[model samples]
Target: MAAKDTKNIKLAKQIYDALSTEFPDSSCSLETDCPQNLAIRGILSAQCTDKRVNITARQLFDRFPDMESIASQEPEVIAEIIKPCGLTASKTKSVMAFAKKMTDEWGGVIPNDVDALMEVPGIGKKIANLIVGEVYGTPAVVVDTHCKRVMKRTGITDSEDPAKVEKDIMKAFPEAQWISIGHLSVDLGRKYCTARAPKCGECPLSSFCKRRI
Candidate 1:
């Protein structure tokens, strides 16, 4: 193989190995019994902590267990239920609109296609990628804050834009490793490679990480 191809293979192996060792049971944080709920939860998670999203989603789901109920509800009511997650006004609109779209257009089902999912309000590229990957078992790079930051520090990507970072990661790693790599990067960011004061000494990729600061 060429030098670039060899490097990509090596990086893919290293990442998979490290992630398996670090977070063997890793998965998305948003709790949901169904894939549609998981997609809705992921949308509500924007600008909000996963804990708060889980709590609010539980309460909201109790009253509105399906797309029809959520679509029928007023945005203000939804906002009140999800106030703890912050960005309530926008999130409420997004959720309500998303629910309506799913009910009317999607036949009360979340579409497995990323493009179709993105057509809904509040479902951006990152969240759409995540939904497709987690719910539909499609391989994709779900670039979040953690993945963007860590990928930059590790010299895997230079852009902070989630879309650009996703492209960079896809180029660096193999298709099979894309989903788990995002999860692993988030774990590394939360545990050792933090933004403010990264614990580089404890990081498995410390030697390979370009950012020592």
Candidate 2:
């Protein structure tokens, strides 16, 4: 892949500036204080909305409350609690398995390393990066649906693959901004650049966004 063009770089900077003004306090929307909980929440957030994950996690956590509680419980029970988030069976197994591993092996703390996070069940590159970034305060590009859509629409990257998109975005933005850029892109996706009907006219990046229609 060739280096990013000047126009794209300028657009990225504009986006960064605009989003910084739009959401100065932007952070991962998941409501959790512990790194282990954040990692589990990020995994459960896959193919599910953050709002739903927050709700479901709150209820589920109220019942289980800790890694030991979750690790000891049956997957069926976990699935029952998380059914509202969809994909209950698999998500439940994943959550339980992840908790068990963390409790048994890591003493209930999430590892700061990306490769270690990927070792957890149901954690892929995207979720792993999210956990590392949000929990560990490490700089990582989290290319979720919103980030991928906005990046593609703005011509920042040509690929739909999350890994490829992440790499492209990491190359475009400075390392210090990677963790916050994911949340900013998500905010832009929700508020202005929606997947169905993006509000191009009112978007902050309208001056440079290639998807203006």
Task: Highest TM-score: give the candidate number.
Answer: 2
| Model 2 pairs whose backbones collide | none
Model 2 lDDT, full chain set: 0.85
lDDT of 2 by residue, 117-143 (tens): 777667888888888888778999999
Q: Least accurate stretch of 10 residues (summed lDDT) in model 1?
A: 4-13
lDDT of 2 at 206: 85
- Highest lDDT scorer: 2
TM-score of each: 0.93, 0.95
**Candidate 2 residue-pair clash tally:** 0
Task: List candidate 1 segments past 4 Å from native.
Answer: 1-9
How much is the lDDT of residue 57 in candidate 1? 92
**80-199, model 1: which lDDT tens digit per residue?**
888888888878888888888888998876788888888877889889988889887799998988888888887777788887888878888888888888888888888998889988
lDDT at residue 200 of model 2 (Cα atoms): 91
